[model samples]
Target: MSRRGLLRTLGTGAATTLAAACGVPAAYVAPSDRSRSDLSATDKRLTWANWPLYIDTDDEDESRRPTLDAFEKRTGIEVTYTEEINDNDEFFGKVSPSLMNHQETGRDLMVISDWMCARFVRLGWVQEMDRSRQPNVTRYLDPQLRSPAFDPGRGYTVPWQSGITGIAYNRRTVGREIRHVSDLWADDLKGRVTLLSGLDEAFALLMQGNGVDITKWTADDFHTVCEQVEKLVRTDHIRRFTGNDYIKDLSSGDVLACQAYSGDVIQLQADDPDIEFVVPEEGAELWSESLMIPNLARHKANAETLVDYYYEPSVAAELAAWVNYVCPVPAAQDILASAKDEETAALAEDPLIFPDTAMRKRLAIARDITAKERTEFAKRWNAIAGL
Candidate 1:
């Protein structure tokens, strides 16, 4: 069954039973439990770097996040949260030198897209978490995110929230229902479709269109899709490759269909009722931006505490409502379902936020490209993108 169908059939029930047995080890323990703390007074304050507009912000002020403030008040740990990360590759380039040298990133806990997190773990630039202090994580992380190809046991990272890379189209402009990946290549979409320029964002769905399993996809599978996209590009079937600017284009009717992230589509839907998102029948990539401790963080314990604090169902619910992304804590879905406001309550039923079992099955975390593969893949993708 398609991932969406799985969700319609299983709903919240599957997450209840499947979450525990996901990627986490039954007898697993974090290395932090055995390590000694070397933190000092200055380390009392930990720096946390995250993507822009990722967390819950005060509705009007935008400067305050009630949940984060409460965490600091209760724990007495100062958190310097900065929305400095604008793009994954840009952030990685900025911190690459420090990470390669094992120097402090000046960030105790940083949130990065999982694919990049895999690079950090592979480079040994992040710390392994202590599971003893993170019982909430061990018990509460959504089953789907438990064991990704990059971090099988998920010892190096934990998801902040998850989302889908799927198709987004303005229904009024397109005047048709787009229900599958093959629809993007239809003649009707010629010169009216945009795909993401970022290789990570664009590749998986294309692979799925060819009916390849992403979890264990091969290099040949990648090149095969690349050649197909090259053919489309040469024929001018694609409008252009883009960044987040695709949102602007879609909103303005300059583009009718494009690849999009689920979180961004939620924002678009608020103003334009015609904007629609769909998880293609062939499957879409289920990706996450995760939190991890940098190699030389001074407050690993405090960071661990903060990570666990967010796992509580109540905390997770508040965040899920604010960010409008897939919640990693299944228990939080029940919380939203009972919200007092109809608007908020409706979010609980949104399949994008808490995908039912069928949707969960269609969702797969694609393997990260190796550095060698990246060079070759980027060359091909950039050529098609006219970069």
Candidate 2:
């Protein structure tokens, strides 16, 4: 789904402030104690919390979700799904009490942006999956997505969908190709460039433009990006920092180029072909809104089965066609190519969704800002972005 809420973004939109809502818990959870009493063996049901408009629906019946229904029918497992996530912080606030208290969230499986997933993983508020039960995920999950710095080997999380943070521009207004991040600062784009207001969504791409290794970026790397942003703010080179509102600015040609999400630009191009998204020559960040089995869930086995079921190439392709984010299962591209509808088949080749080899080489997943780093970083970034 294209999240339109001011705070709703592709990943954890609250990088700096997420931890402030709760002073970092002094207690840590041992791995042996994270699992709750399992009910999957006896109960044929599980609950899933996710964002709205995220799954493939039947064309004539919005009530029916095709892949989800298929999974229920195939496994005799009933999934009671709810679209309860509107804002990342709001959802975190809702669930943190239970996760912090070591109680069940009453949800078996839930999806949250990977940036937030890092917090859950770090605090040991989520349980690791037994990979032997997720063979499809093992076989089809994209290798590029396998080892994010926050969750090495993905022992505790699986990506639900993926996206790229890159540059977007209106070719007609800019009157030149924007091949690198530096182009956003060109004299032609002065006072006509925008950036994402959220700290997490904005920093990695900016750091990448400076040739920093995002996966192992340091305190110095972060401050260097902040210093440049502070200068740009002083010079009026940046018109504003916004959320998805950048879409409106780009569409109106008020801004020639700005940092943008791949999926948002694809939708923009359908209406205005002049809009373009670039994974800069330096690189871009590939991030996900991922799924995690929260602390103590009764349906761990069923949730694991459901997670792996979505990893099946055919199931993943159906979802890719609907939501139009980067698909985490690379093999799904082939399934999309053979889709019955020609347009759907062509989507299989969209470099934004299934980026080709050349583009893949320029993408990296930056390590998430830690709880220790959040306070200082958020203070600096929010001050500069004016959020």
Candidate 3:
């Protein structure tokens, strides 16, 4: 499924299950019990679970992933890569039973959104990584993403890819530049705008529009945006709420402007020059789908090695050239700029992929909605979104 299609399926039922899992005391694993004897020295293999189409793939042969193939050849650690994670809540439902019962999840490493990573950190479902084994991550990981509120100093998670939740518009169709989140509400855009429907995906950018520091926004800040959205929906100003389908709306000129992911807009711009993505003046949310090691992962040391290897600028550049999200390794910009292929070198200049200094100033990582806030907030946001 497309990333947006997977995200669109995140319904209330899955969210309810996530909220319920938070309160069960047995679900919390103590630090002392989080690791098993490392078999990495002899096992020579590891498994990884991630979302579909998230990594660099050979253009002619989709089954062959270049960077991953190189990793196995260099390190002799055969990787069992599965694109099994479609939705955060759904994946949590699949794995939570074993994690809470103190059993191996049969996977060594997995990538999930940082918001969900926060939940795992709180519940102690993942093991802390040994950074001594990951020096490249220690040096090259982007400074902006280094210290998220949920995993301060990042003891448990390493960002796989980072992106912005910002405004996207068809410059020709909209007939103006969208410089702020509030720009979507202009009279000319009435009935031509769409917002994301999922609560976790939608709220941070809206909160940023109100000039709230999303890193520490309050309940009132959330409700204030809710009220505004309700008004827009009531008046038919918003054409509809959307998932990844917003890409289609913007591309077809059916919708002039909407909330969109930075990475998706990159693909859109490749096909339609008029499509533009903006990190609004008020600010935009910087989020990541991160890699984490689950408790009892037998190949813990090998998994950590794989994580660090990607942090190398050359390998990171190869992956960044294909995926085109914001590269978490800033040094990779230089690598891309010097590539033999001009088209590959041009990726170095795409601000959406490697944000310029000015754009970097306007990005902030939003504090995730807490377990205590999840149930109530999802109920309200889902109602307004008509989910």
TM-scores of the candidates are 0.88, 0.95, 0.96
lDDT tens per residue, model 1, 1-387? 222222223333322332232222212223343223548344666789986667888988879988899999998888999877655555666676666554577778888889888777766667888899899999999988999988888998999989999999999989999988889888988998999876888999999989999988999999998888888888888899876778888999989999988877887899998999989889999998899987777788888889999998889999999888899998898999999999989999888899998888788889899756876787777777766
Question: Model 1: C-alpha RMSD to truth?
Answer: 9.5
Which stretches of model 2 miss by more than 4 angstroms?
4-20, 24-26
Candidate 2, residues 1-387: lDDT per residue as tens digits?
255432355434454445544554535678888887889999999999998778889999999999999999999999999988866776887788788888889999999889989988988889999999999989998999998988999999999999999999988877889888887889868899999988889999999989998999999999999999999999999999988888888888888899999988888899999888999999999999999998889999999999999999999999999888999999999998998899999999999999999999999998999989987998899889876
Supply candidate 3's per-residue lDDT for 196.
92
lDDT of 3: 0.91
Q: Write the per-residue lDDT of candidate 3 for residues 13-57, one digit (tens) a residue.
A: 655665665445546899999899999999999999998888899
Report lDDT (CA) for all predictions.
Answer: 0.81, 0.89, 0.91
Ranking by lDDT: 3, 2, 1
Those runs of model 1 whose alpha carbons end farther than 4 Å from true positions after fitting are 1-37, 40-43
Backbone clashes in model 3, listed as residue pairs: none
* Candidates sorted by TM-score, best first: 3, 2, 1
For model 3, the superposed segments whose C-alpha errors exceed 4 Å read 1-26
